[model samples]
Target: MLSRRLISIAGAFSLALTITACGTTTRQQVGIGTGAVLGGVAGSAVTNGSTLGTVGGAAVGGVIGNEVAKKKK
Candidate 1:
């Protein structure tokens, strides 16, 4: 349980770092990455550490984030 929580936290932190580092790039990429990270974390948490759920969440999140970023212009 604790380990899972740690992993989730690490994932979130890693995502934050990734997004921040890429902030200067295209907003679409940043949004997609952010979404993927957030979705992965949520999916992992909800699915009790299922890899499939995490990946699926990331994919969906990435798409949504990408669309949103593109619209922000």
Candidate 2:
């Protein structure tokens, strides 16, 4: 039961990201989106579909992605 819920949450998260990623055209945007998807999936799996976990994971992942995409001067 819990596994099913987690799967659903991950699926929904992935779908949402896919829809949103369609118009992205920058490395930062791609990074953020990819991070969000991976984070959300990992978060959901780790937390058993916890809303906070998924959101927090996405936030953290986005920050990480942004940093990774930063250009060195």
Candidate 3:
């Protein structure tokens, strides 16, 4: 279980990095990547390693991060 969670977290981070490195990432994209990382970590911790919680938290965080970035525009 622990290994699976770690793998998921690693995969999430890798995906975020890949997205960010795809060239010409805007503020919103950066926010999404950053938020996903933070949110996934937070969610996993808060939900006692629940995958659904991690994903939901990442989705929520991504939206919030994007909105916050938009405010600066």
Candidate 4:
């Protein structure tokens, strides 16, 4: 059951990325979006679908993504 749910989430995220691949976006934007999706998915799995967990995960993921995508000078 958990595997199926994760697969579904991955599939949905992939589809969304593919659909928007043609759009112009910064690396940071892409990173944040990817992180948020993955974080939300992970949070949902870890917390058994708890809303707070999902949101918290997304927030954390977004911050991590932003830092990761930062331009190094």
Candidate 1 stretches with Cα past 4 Å from truth are 12-16, 19-23
lDDT of 4 by residue, 28-70 (tens): 8877877777776777678876667767777787678778988
lDDT (Cα, 0-100) at 64 in candidate 3: 78
Model 4, runs deviating above 4 Å: 1-23
Summarize candidate 2's per-residue lDDT along 2-65 as a digit string, tens digits. 8765665666577657756677567777777677777776776677778777777777777787
Each candidate: what lDDT? 0.76, 0.71, 0.82, 0.72
TM-score of each: 0.70, 0.69, 0.84, 0.69
Clashing residue pairs, backbone N/CA/C < 3 A, model 4: none
**Model 3, residue 29: what's the lDDT?**
91
Q: What is the lDDT of residue 51 in candidate 2?
A: 75
lDDT top scorer: 3
Count clashes in each candidate, considering only residues at least 3 apart in sequence or on different chains: 0, 0, 0, 0
Backbone clashes in model 4? 0
72 Cα displacement, candidate 4 (Å) = 1.0
> What ordering of candidates by TM-score runs from best to worst?
3, 1, 2, 4
